[model samples]
Structures are given as structure tokens and as C-alpha cells.
Target chain A: MIPAEGFFWSWILPALIFGVSLWATVALYRRFSR
Target chain B: MIRFGSIDIFWTSLFLLLMVGGAFWFYRLARRSESDFFLAGRGLPWWLPASSVFSTHTATDTPMWITGVIYKDGLRGLWYTFFSAWTAIGAFVAARIFRRSLAYTQAEWQSLRFSGLGAELLRGWMAGWQVFMNMFILGWVGIAMGKVGELVFGWPVWVGLIVPSLITAIYTLAAGYWGVVMGDFLQGIVAVFAILLVSLVGVVAAGGPGEITGKLVELGQEWRLDPFAFTGVSDGDFPMLWWLTMLVIAVVGGFGMGTSIDWYVEAQRIQSAKTVRDATYGLWAGGAITLIRNAFWAVSILAFFVMLPDIKDTAVSELGWFRLGFELLPMGLIGVFFGAILAIHLSTISSHLNLGALYFTRDLYQRYLNPEASEQKLVVVGRWTTAVLLIGSFFYGMMMEEITQWLIFALWLMSAGIWLPNILQVVWWRFNAWGYLAAWMANLGVSWLVVWILPGFNLLPELPDHIQFWLLMALGACFFLPATFLTKPEPMDRLVQYYVMTRPLGWWGPVHREAVRRGLIEETKKESGPVTRSMGIRRSWTPEAAQEWTREDWIAILLSPLVYTGLLFGLVQVLLMQMEGFALLGAAVIGTLIIYWVIDPKLKAVSEEFEAGQARFLDEVEARSRWEEA
Candidate 1:
């Protein structure tokens, strides 16, 4: 079985990075909406 | 050789069709004008080009190189990848400055930054060099994909190189940057997902993080887990001096354009963004994600090490990550992984194909051959050039083995000598076209002697890479510094105009003072105030107020390196389940948030003001190109 830290690095951290990037994009779109 | 199931073939075929077909959707937009073909009309939302930046950098060979270093040096290998940190400060400094200047490529920026016959010569030389360099990059990357194909499907390397490149070329030829950027967005998503999935699976297959660590300890290889386990200050294979050199290069290189090789690629994305704020955030976020991806790969490579601790040959061991996935992934998922590999390959190929074409079309043909070329004619030329680059890459890919020696020399050729001059051109107002040109010429001869020729003759010992970089920089300065002082400065009017438009950072005092004297700009409070206030941190900015370099910009610049360092080290530690990792990661996040809060408003204001005058600036650039103005 994968340890919690292993799962976090392999899974959760990547997901969080992607999530934050997506959120930033949405925020940019909203702020600079044409 | 690994056997592929029916499900694997199905997934791979579907992904190929989807990416290629999706690119065609932009065919009409790409054909509308020269700008559309090369720069997507410079109206892209930040995210679109941000995805392109991330996707383009994550080429087919990226995983191989990362795995090779991690397997050999343990966690300290992560520092090798940290060179991407240049973008952290570059997003705030060079990206903003270049966006405001409105140059199509770094080659074109040459003419804007310098003047007279020297500027034109530099522009032509730079344009030609970029075209050749891009082809070289395409060849190297293509050959890497060819190797992967050989490994997985038992296909000939030539067949592997040509097929995918041909497929990517179809869309690149049809829709230009429009297709490349749009396709890259989709590819980036798929590539990231595959990377995460494959890395996680590798960890699970290796008996998890805890087991991997325990095994390393049992084998007396626990030092591999320590990121700071350097051999010595200057003695061992992985020395502190080399790390220090990397830190300086990565962080300080940001203040200038073209400091890192990746800057040329990122320049296109910076200009393509809809606004300056978008450009800044896009670059920062893309680079941040890339470093994060490296952290994941670093950890997974460790897992590979624990499983197979005795592999010696770099050629076989470099394939460690791939071995883990292909050997361990289930049938249907293997196909999905292969599809992602195609995504990785195609994104990089398409980007370089389009980029090389831009240099040829904009800088070489239009500037020299036909100043009166129409938009339709220029786009036609762009298509033909894309085809040529694609054909050239095939020949280059096939002959890569014979040229590998020269390729290493070529890599050093660009970085070591020209690095400081690259920074000087941006920050120092007095650095003219002659000095810049002389630097390139001097570097060519000096680097050949320092890196190879002298060593071959036994006149000089073979030096470490970092020592060579410093040696090249010092020797190069001897020639270019004299060339700058001996030659006349760029015309005062030209310097004033450039200063007004770009508001560049660093020692531009004379230009700034002249602009104020001419009533071209307001006399700002002393420039030193902002530099001083950078330490305190803080601003709301009016469009006029934002034009001046201020504390907010300084604060962002100061914090950017910290954030990048924190993210790189923090992610690695967290992967190892260390407590300090959590703290470092938190600090990085907080730093990022503060930068956004401090700088975003000013950037928006700067973009708004700059766009209003961009049309006038474009006309001036056109007139200058035609020699209609002196």
C-alpha cells in the first residue's frame, strides 16, 4: 500500500498545483473579462 | 520489447486523432494576417499561452534527463533542474519590459534595443542563429523520441523520428501559433495527468515511500535521501561551488532577456498574452508548475533507485522512469500512458516548428528580401518555411549520433560567454550593438579554446562545467567591455524613445534623465526611493503612476526567487514526509499570494497605458525596419 506522504506527493500535491493554476486562470479571466 | 494490448492501441489512436483534429479548428484565424500566424494576434488569455509554456518545456527527453540525474546523484540532482527558476524573476522584469516594447521576436528586439548599421547586423545574425538553433533543438528532441520508439515498439529510430513529426507538422503548417497554442493546452493537461499517474504507480510498485526509505537505509544508501549531501565545497563530483554557480545563474539571470535558453521560447508566450498582468502571471505559474512536476519526478526516480539499486550504465538507467511505467502499468492504462507520451512529443515539435518559422518569416525574409510584402504573402512564406524546418529536422534527427560531440560544444557556445552580455543589454543603457555583437564573436573563439581546443592540446586542464562558465564570462568581458567603451553610444533620441516605452530596470540613469528633460515623461521622485522601499514592501497605481518603476515591482522581484527556492526544496521534503517541507511550502504559497496582491494592480495599469500607445509604436517599428526613419 502507498503511504499517506507518498499518495500526497504523487497525487494530492499535483492536484493542488493544478487546482491553484486553474483558479488563477479563472480569476484572471474574471478580472480582465472582455 | 513490451507487447501492447488492443486497448493500448485504441487509446493511443484516439489521442492522436483528437489532438491533430482539434488543431485544425484554428485554420481560418491563423491565415488572417502575419501577426495571427506568428503570435496568435497577441490577444491570447494568460492561461492559453501559460499552458503552452508548460507543455513546450515538458518535452519527450525531459523525463529521461531528470531520471538520469536523480539516479546518479540522489536528491541533490534536483538542483540541476532548478535552472528554470530564472522565470520566477523574469515574469516581473523582462516579460513586462519586452511586452511593452512590442517586438515580435528577440531578434527584432535587437533592432529596437540598439541602433545604426550595427543593430541591423545583429538582427540578421540573431535571426539566422535562432533558425539554426531551433532546428538543432528539434533534431535532438526528435532523436530522443526516436530512442523511446526503439525501446517500446522495436521500431527503427528513423521511423520513430519522422512519423510523429510529420503528423505534428500538418497542424503547425495549417494553423500556425493558433493551432500550436490551442493544441498545447490540451496536451499540457494530458501530459500532467500522465506524469502524475505514472509516478504514483511507480511508487506503489516499489512498495511505497516508507518501504523505499527503509530499503535505502538497509542498503546503506540513505545519503541519497539528503538533498544537501554535497561532496565538498570544491572537491567532489557534486560541489557546493557548482550549486552556488547554478543559484547565481538561475536567480540573477532573470533581470535580463535571453539569459537562459528557455527565455527565447517564453518570449513568444509573453507577447501572445492579452495583457501584461496575464503575461506575468502566466509565466510565473507555468514555471512554478514545471518545478512542481520535477519534484514529483525526483521522488518517483528515488522509488526506482530503491527497486533497482545496482544499474550502472547511464544509457539503461536513464530509461528508469519509462521502465517503471511500461513494466508495471496495466494493459489499458499502458495505452493511456503512450497517448500522453505522444502529447509530450507533439507539443514540443509543434512549438519549435512554429518558432523557427517565425524567425525565418519575420526577421530574415520580410526584413531583408521584401519590405513591401503583404500579410497574405507573409503567411504563405511562413507556411513554406514551416515545411522546410520539418524536412530539415528529419535529416538532423537521423545524423544526431555523429553530431553529439559538436552538440555539447554548441550548448556551451550559447550560454557561457553571452550570459553576462545578455543581462547587460537589458539593464545597462550604454551597452550598444557593437559590444553585443563583439561579445558573440569573441565568445565563439574564446569558448572553443577554453572548452575544447586548448584541452585537446594539453595546454589547459579539462575544467568543471561551472568553472568553464566563470572562465568564459571573465574572458568574454575582456573583449566586449572594451568594445562598448571604444564605440559611440546609441543615439540619444533612440535611447530616450526605448526608455519611454519599456521603462526598463537597472542603470538607465542617463536615459531616464534625458527623457525627463525632453518632457517625454514626468520627473519621478528619486529612483532610489523605490529600491529602498522594496525592503518595506507595498501599492495602488494610476496608469501614469504605474509607468515609473516602483516599490511594488521591486518587492515582487525580491520575493520571486525566495518563492521559487521554497517551492523546489519544500516539495521535495514533503514528498519525503518531512515537517520542514510543510513549512517551506507554506512560505512559498504565502510569498506567491503577497506578490500577486502587491504587483497585480500596477501591472494592470501599466498594460492599460502601454496598449493605448502600442499602435503608434508599431508604426514606428515598421518605419524603422524600412529605413523610412533614421
Candidate 2:
């Protein structure tokens, strides 16, 4: 079995996710309005 | 390292109070009316359902299960993660096209969509299989929760196993969806917060995310980023192809399974929006946040594996959760997070426990046993079903030595089992009842014959793994559509009428008199059929669906929830991001206020547009489409 590798950077993804969600919310809402 | 600690009186009191209080608060809404019990009286705005979608999907052992995979593989689990993105996105797609589809459960939708021998066969298999699959899935969730309980509080294995299930059944039986949904909303919030807290604390505890990475690099374990980085130990254990194969199954073919209503919390969120516009906004935004949350757990586990390799691999039993909690959180926070786990587990247990009973009452008992049963009687049967099934669910988990495997299998089976007949029939014009029947039979056969036999073969070679069975069933189901379509097409009048009301752009043929007549035709006219309404869905699905739903009140509902979710997400991002530009801040503030203004007006304008469909929705939801409909 390949040894499991350990690394940490899950935090940034959530932040990035927060960003993408906002962008999506704004965009989808705008499309809905128009 | 993470700290395992005791829950003081404050937390102990808080946990009990929240568990008891939250359950009651939710059930109180159910008392307002049976509709309230089953459908939250359709009073809640989009945000609650949207948020609960994430919460509902975030099960007790989900983090550990997914994390366990990452611990074993590297970023390869992203195959599961990315394809799974289609869950919300596909739901959003469905929401836009079929916003009012929530009026019935998934099986009822199948029954309504098909007719003759095929329809009967399809519905029967669906109703039965729905129960079997739901019970199995609910069992894992029950086990995971109990396991967590045993690990955390040092409770007896049996007590830990039984308590949450019993407590959840009580609330779900009393409040029905109202109890589950209301409780889920809060639990979902706790889950997101708990995830955030754990990640932040884990990072700080590990001396920052950067430090965690540095430590990992020093340990010679920094090669996890190359999604395909693996030293092949087994032939088909996993190559790059494994990731690619999973991506196709999970992402591409996943849309087929998107229509199942087992987790109708998300569907209700979309359905209960002030307007189709507002509802989709909540779902879209909520879905977006949820996807991010999934990624958070995904990456955090990467840090975890690097941070504490000695933490050791553990099963999804009580001992495993106990060790994980202590190693992952600080003192008071551990108590707080453990409480969150209870909330998560209870939300699932109550939802499934009640839903499982719902299937028994609606699909089997009412349809098969008592056709004339009143809603009041069904309600009683449903409660009893919940009670009995929940007790059974507790033991279901205990039977599994490696509960997580069963849990994962349950999920895959649930997804693949219904994936074939659900989406393809709804969205694809070529799909038919015969195909759905075939798909279900193949799924049932494979699930029983192949999955049942995986354990014996795993110790040796030559036997297909359980997951491979899932892939085969999903593929076979999807492929069934094209094969059946070539041989036969149901007449336009019978099933097509249902399609006409639900889909405007999707029905085939040119956009003239022929198309109008074709669109207007139902199943009754199939003997003298016009041309097929082929092509694909039109661009204006959301607005068009709303137009059929509400004549003049379209713009308001469409705009308001959008504004509501917009303001909320926009405000959240601005506060969290704090970027340098005045443009950014102005855009955030302006966008939010605009959305807020739209919510009230749209809600007021379209208040009564939904009245007629409400009864039908109740019929399907409370009767034909109950929880097992998923």
C-alpha cells in the first residue's frame, strides 16, 4: 500500500469557496431578476 | 494533536437543553397543521431549506468517512468531491425546470410519468427498493451517531447506539418534516460552524495552516497534490484511470440520480421559496456554500493525515469517533463540537427514521393495503412506522463490523439505484417507463446478487468490489435509456401530457402549429401522434416555468429570493473577504439591498398562485410521495 501523505490547506479552499458562492449567488440572482 | 476532554455541567446542560428544546421547537410547528408537520406549512423562506440542505447532507460519520478515504488515497477523492458537485447543481437545474415538482414524492413522480404494465412494475420495484435502500442508509447513520456517542461520553455501546435513534424518532414522529426540517436547519448551522471551528482550531493547534504544510513537507509526505500521484500496489487498486472513472460516474452520470426525493430538504428549500426566483437563489447559494464546506473537510483531512500520522486508521465505530474528537478539538470546544455531532446525527436519524416509516405508510400500506385511508389515518400509521423502524435501524448499524463500508455502500446504492429512472425520464425526452423498469431490475439484481457477494470475494481475487457494482448499475441504467428508446417510444398523449405541463421548452418538434398541437397532446392522443417534441430544453426555463405557475406575479417571486440570497451571500463575502476596492464594497452593498427589496414584493404578489398545487403536493408528499419516495 502507498503510504498516506499528510498536508494541510483546507482553510484556503473554504475561503475560496466562500468567494465562488458569493459570485454565484450574485450572478444567479441577477439572472433571476432579469 | 487534538484534545479529548470532559463535558462540564455547562455543556452537558446545554447539550440536553438544545436536544430537547430544539426538537420541541420544531415539533410545535407541526401542531399548527398536518401540512405544517409534513411540509413546514410551506411558511419558511428559501434560506431555511437551503441551509438545511447542507446540514441534512452533512451526516454524522460523513466527515470521518470522506477523511478516511483521503487518509488512504491522496487528492483522488476529489473525483468523488467534484462529481458530487452535480448534486446541488443538478438540483438547481431541476429547480429551474420543475420548481413545482415537489408537489409529489419521487416514486409518485415515476408512477405519474409512466403507465400500463411498465409503470406498475416500475412503481412497485421503486416503492419496495426505496424502503430497502433507505433502511440500510439510515442504519449506517444510526450506527455512526451511536458510535460517536459511545466514543465521546463513555456511554455503553448499546446506550450510545440506541439513544439518538429513539430521541430522533420521537421528534420526527411528532413533528414529521416540520420537526426534521426545523431541527435540521439548526443542526446544519451547527455543522458548518463546527467544521469551521475544528478547521480553525486544528490549524492553530497544528501551528497554522502554513506550518502544518511545512511539517508535512519535512516528513516527506508533501506529494499529495498531484491528483494522480500513486505507486501502484494493486493492479486495479487505483490508477489515474480510477480517478477518471469515478469522475465520470459521480459527475457525468450523477445527473441521472439527481431527482430522488430522499433528501427532500433541499427540494423543499427550492419549493418553499417566496417565488421560484427566490427559491432557486436559496438553493443555488446554499448549494454553493455546501460545496465549499465539502472542500473544507477534504483539505482539512489532508492536514490531519500530515499532522498526526500516528492518529491511526479507525473504523466509523464509537471508539473511532472518540479518538478523533479528542485529537481534533480543544476542551470546551470539544464539548460544543460533540453537541454538534449529536445535532447532525439526530437530524439525519429523525429525517430518515420518519421518512422510512413514511414509505411504509404511503407506498406500501396505503397503495397496497388500504386504498381509502384518510390523511389522519396515514399520519398515525406513519408515526408507528417511524417508531418501529427506528428501533430496527439501531441494530442495523451494530451488525456491521466496519460500519463505514456499509455506509458508503448504502450511499452509492441509493444514488445509483434511482439515478437511471429519475433524471433521464424527467429531462430526457427519449426515456420511458420500460427503461426505468429495466434499470431498477438491473440495479436490484446487481445490488442483491453482486453487492451481496462482494465480501466473500474481497479476501480473494476475481470478485468485483461493491463500488464496482455501483458503477456497473449506474452505467447499465443510463445505457438502458438509449437501448429502450431505439426499440419503442410511448405514445405522445398519455405520458406526454404530464411532460407538457411540466416542460414547455423540452417537448420536441418545430415551434409552430405542429409544435403547439404536439405540446398540447397528452397520453390520450398518442394513437394519432404528431411529431416528437425533440431538440432539447429551451433557454428560458425558469421564467417559462414561472409563467405557467403564476400569470402576472412572475417577476416578483423570481426577483425576491434572488435578492434575499444575494444580500445574504454578498454581505457574508464582503465581511469575510475585506478586499481593497471601494468598487467591491459598493457592489456588495448595492447587490444585497436590491435583493432584499425584491423578497417582500414577490412574496406578497404571488401568495395565492400556489394554492391549487398545494393539495396535490400534500397528496403526494403526505401520501404517495412520503419519505421513502426518495
Candidate 3:
């Protein structure tokens, strides 16, 4: 099994990138819709 | 072959049902009109098309291609993928200009940008070429799916090519781009999740990051870890000169539309956006995510390399990422992974189907065959065209025995010779339709001679790909530049109208003055006074002021490449736990923040001003399509 740091870099970091992108899209939609 | 369990079947079925059912739900909206079918009614918010951009670009072949390069050249191979970075500057520059033009297709934009017989011929040529290109893309991508199916279930290649494409065609035929963009949002999420999960599992399977790095040092391949590992300035497989050429192509090429073949697909997304700002942000954000996703794939491929360092065949090694997901993932999760693969495949298929149909319906059928075709008849023609393309792709896919060779040739054919002309069309007022048309005709013959004909005859040495690019570009310029000067410039009225509408940047001094003289727009003061008081950057912009090129736009264009480079190298290094990676990532973030700060206000002003006149411009576009105006 990978250590916690390795796991974070390999998985969590990319997950964060995706999550943030999706969130920003939502926010942009709200801003523009208004 | 791997066996599928009940849970695996359930997950796979669930994804398919959701994608097809959800897309079919948009039938009513897509059937509304030609615009609604082709462009989602030109009312999509930034995120909707943004997601579509990400998902549609992430084809089944993408991982295989990325894995092949990363496995061969290590981190340095990522430069091959960086060509997508055109969007970094393009979002601010070309995307804005294109959104203002409000043309439904780039082929249609040709006529709008130029006038008379030359413009008409160029538009016709571009429309037909786009139809062929889109069908070609569908074939290659479909064959990639066929290969995957063969590996997984022992199916014949044709079964793999035809089945999923026919399923994807269902939604495309039913709902057009409405189905495409909506379906893409869901697929984008699933695809991203799968890439992260499988990559994480692969890294763990390589005995973790610590072992992988230590093993690389033991094997004397530590250079693979360096993103800038150039073999030499002019020699070897990965040369410094090649890297520089790629950087120039990726960054500077952004100033022009259609510099990359990908630009044709992006044109649709840019028009689908509701406003100029939405289009800009959508394109930039989508491209950002694509690069970040590449970084993740790079790290995972590195892990694959460490685990199996002795794999000699590139074909076998190219399956590295898929092998990680299939061979390493747990049973139930394997199904989810396969579902994501299907998502990637279907998204690409659906997009090209609709896009090809758009070119056929709007540019060919509606424009030439029946100018007065009703909206309902056009949508029906679109559906019929979608079906025809699906059938055509099967023939192309079956005939294509070698994917990599054809893919490389096609990319070179599209990019190298036409690169300069693509930019000149956007920037130079003198580059009329005849000149652009001549460039396309010349590029075809020149590229053939430089890439294959002369080299095969042993008259020319087999030069490196970068050298070929430069040679092809130089020779192409010799033909097209003369053709441009020999022909008269586009008529003053046509030039003035294009100038006032799109407000294109660079070398448009005469047109700008004419627009001002005619009172089509106001001339701005030099504004060394109160207007220029803020932070040495002009923050406030009137619509007229924003129409002119400014220092802020230049700053964003120059810094954009640095951001892409930083994110690409930084993420890979960070995954390897390197300290410098963190620093580079920080620099990239700062660069992005600065770009947004400097440019957003001007973009907003320009978008607001342009949108106010959009309805009138749109009606004019409709008139041109019907040949009601010359």
C-alpha cells in the first residue's frame, strides 16, 4: 500500500483539481445567470 | 480476458442508461431550430461547454497516445501534449474575436471575414474539407475503441467499431449538440474520477512513490524524472530545438483561429457560449483541466515504467494505463473503470457526429442545396447526415490498418504549412480570401513533397520532424505570400464591416482609421491623464477603448505559456514529492491570478458592448446564408 503522502499526491491532489474545476463552473454559471 | 461479475455488469449498464436516457431527454430542445441543433441555441453558460470540451477531447485513444509517449521519453514526452496550450492565450484573444463574429461554423466565418467569389469558394472548400476531416476523426477514434474491445472481450474489430458508435449516434441523431453538451458534463466527471482512481492504484502497485524513484536511480534512468531532459541542442530523439519549436507552436499559434485542427471543434464551443466572457473562461478552464489530467497520466505511466522496465514493444507498452485499471483494480471497481472508458469513447463519438453533421447541414445542404430550407427540414437533414457519417466512419476505420502513422501524417498535414497563414488571416488586413485559399492549396502539395514525396525519392534526406515543419512552413510562405500581394485586398466596405464587427488585432491600422472616420466607432484619447492612473495597467475600458489592442492583452498572452509550462511540469514533480515542484506550482497560481486581474475588466467591457449589437449582427449572418446579401 502507498504511504499517506504518496496517496495524497497520486489521488487526492487530482481529485481536488477536478472538484475545484466543477465548483468554479457552477459559480460561473450562477454569476452569468444573474 | 477478464471475467465480469454481477456488480460489474450493473455499473456498466447504469452508466450507459444514464448517458443515452439523459441525452434523449434533450430531443425537444434540439429539434427547435438549426441553431439549437448545431450550437445549443447559442445560449450555453461557460461551464456546460467547458465540460463538453474536456470530455469530448478525452477520447479512448488519448490515454493510449499519452502512455506511449510518456513510456518512451519519460516526463519530457509531455511536451507533445502541450500543443493544447493554444487555448491559454486563445481564450483571451482568438476566442473573444470569434465569439464577436457569431458565425455558426468556421467555414461560415470564412465568408463573413472575406467577400465576393473568392470568399464563396473558400467557404465551400472549407465546409467540404471539414466534413471529410470530422468523418476521418470519427473513424480513427472508433477504431481505437475497436482495439480496446478486442483486448477486453475478444470481439472482432468491426463489431467494436460499429456497435458503440451506433449507440452514440442514437443520441446525436435525436438531440444534436444539445444531447452532446449535456451528456458530456456527466461523462467528464466520471472520466476524471476514473483516471485519478486507476492512476492511484497503479502508483501503489509499483511499490509506492519512494520505491519507484529509488528504482529509477538504480536503473540509471533518473533523467526520466526531469521534465526538461533534452538529449542535445540538435541531435538525438528529444532535442532542445524540438522543444523550442513546440513551445512556439503552442503559444504563438494562439493569436490565430484554426492553427490547430482542434481549433475547428473549439469554434463550436466558443459560439455555444452565451457571452464573450463565458466563451473565454470556458475555453481556458477546459484546457487547464486537460493539462492537469495529462500530468496525472504522466505520473501513472512513470509508475508503469518502474514496474515493468523491460517492455520493448511500444504497442504493448502503450496499453500501460488501461492495463493498470484492468489488471490491478478490484473486481467491482473494474466495472466502474470500464464504464468510464465507455464514457470517454461515447463522448468523443457523439461530439464528432454532431459537429460533422453541422458542417454538412449548415454549410453544404442549407447553403448550397436549398437556401430557403425550413428549420424543421434542416434538423431532419442533420439527423440524416449524422447517420451517413456513422456509416462512412466504419469504412474508413476498416481501411485504416496503421493508426499511429496516419495520425502523425494527418496532424502534420493540418498544422505545419498552414500555421503562418492561419495567423496572418486573423492579424493582417491584406490577407484576403484568395490568399488564404491559395495557402490551403499550396500547403497540400508542399507538405506532400517535404514530408513524403522528396524524402521517399532519396532526393531529400530524412530530416527530423521539427526541420520538416520549418521547411514546409518556409516553402508554403513562398507560394501564398506572392498570391496574397498579386490579388487585390478585400473591398474597403467588406474590410470595414469585418473590422467594426470582430475588432481583430494587429496590422489593421488602415481599417481602424476608416471605421473611426466613418463614425462607426469613436477614437479614444491617449489618456495620459486620469484614465491611466492605476498600477501602470489600464483597468477601466470603454467598449471602443477595449476594441483596440492594449498592454494588458499582451501581458496575458506572454504569461499564458509560462502558466501552462508550470502546471504541466509542476504537477508531475509534485506527484514525485519534489520541493521545486511546489515552488513552480505557486508561481503558476500567481501568474494566473495576475492574468485574470489585468484582462478581465477589458473583456467584460468588450463583451457587453458587442452583445448589445449581437441581434443585428446575427440577423445579418442569417441574411448572408440565404444569399439575400452579397
How many pairs collide in each candidate, listed in order?
A: 0, 22, 0
Cα distance off (Å), candidate 1, residue B162: 0.2
Which candidate achieves the best TM-score against the true structure?
3
Candidate 2 differs from the real structure by a C-alpha RMSD in angstroms, to one decimal, of 9.9
| Recovery fraction of native interface contacts for candidate 1 | 0.00
Which scores higher on DockQ, 1 or 2?
1
Query: Comparing candidate 1 with candidate 2, which one achieves the higher lDDT?
Result: 1
Candidate 3 chain B, which ten residues in sequence have the lowest lDDT sum?
Answer: B525-534
Worst 10 residues of 2 chain B by lDDT: B531-540
CA RMSD per model (angstroms)? 4.4, 9.9, 3.8
Q: Assess the local accuracy of residue B439 in candidate 2 as a C-alpha lDDT between 0 and 100.
A: 70
**Residue B165, model 3, lDDT:** 93
Put the candidates in lDDT order, highest first.
3, 1, 2
lDDT of 3 by residue, B1-630 (tens): 676667677667766776676676677788989998999888888888888889989999999999999999998899999999999989988998899998888899898889999988988888898888888899999999999999988999888799999889888899899889877886787788789989888888888778878989999999998878998999999999999999878888899999988999999999999999899989998899899999999999999998888889988999989988888876666777887899899999999999999999999998899999999999999999999999998988988776658666877888988999999999999998888988989999988887788989999998898988898889888888999999999999999988899999889999999998999988886534457536888878777788788898998888888898898888887888888899999999899999999988988998899889999989888988999983
Q: How far out, in Å, is residue A28 in model 2? A: 26
- DockQ for all models: 0.07, 0.03, 0.08
lDDT of 2 by residue, B1-630 (tens): 234434333453465455545555455446554345455655556766676666767787777766776666655554444443444334334554445544323554556566556765766666676666667767777766666666555666667667777777767878787667667765665567667766555445556556655776787876554346645633455654555554445434423434344334344445555455555556655655665665556555655666556655356321332344456554555655666777777776776665566556656787678777766776777777777777666667678566667666656665656565566676556577778667766665666545566545674344334346456555676657665766566555544445543442233343223435664532222234232222321222222233333322233334333333333334322322324323444554575454344333333332344444546544654443333341
**TM values, all candidates:** 0.93, 0.72, 0.94
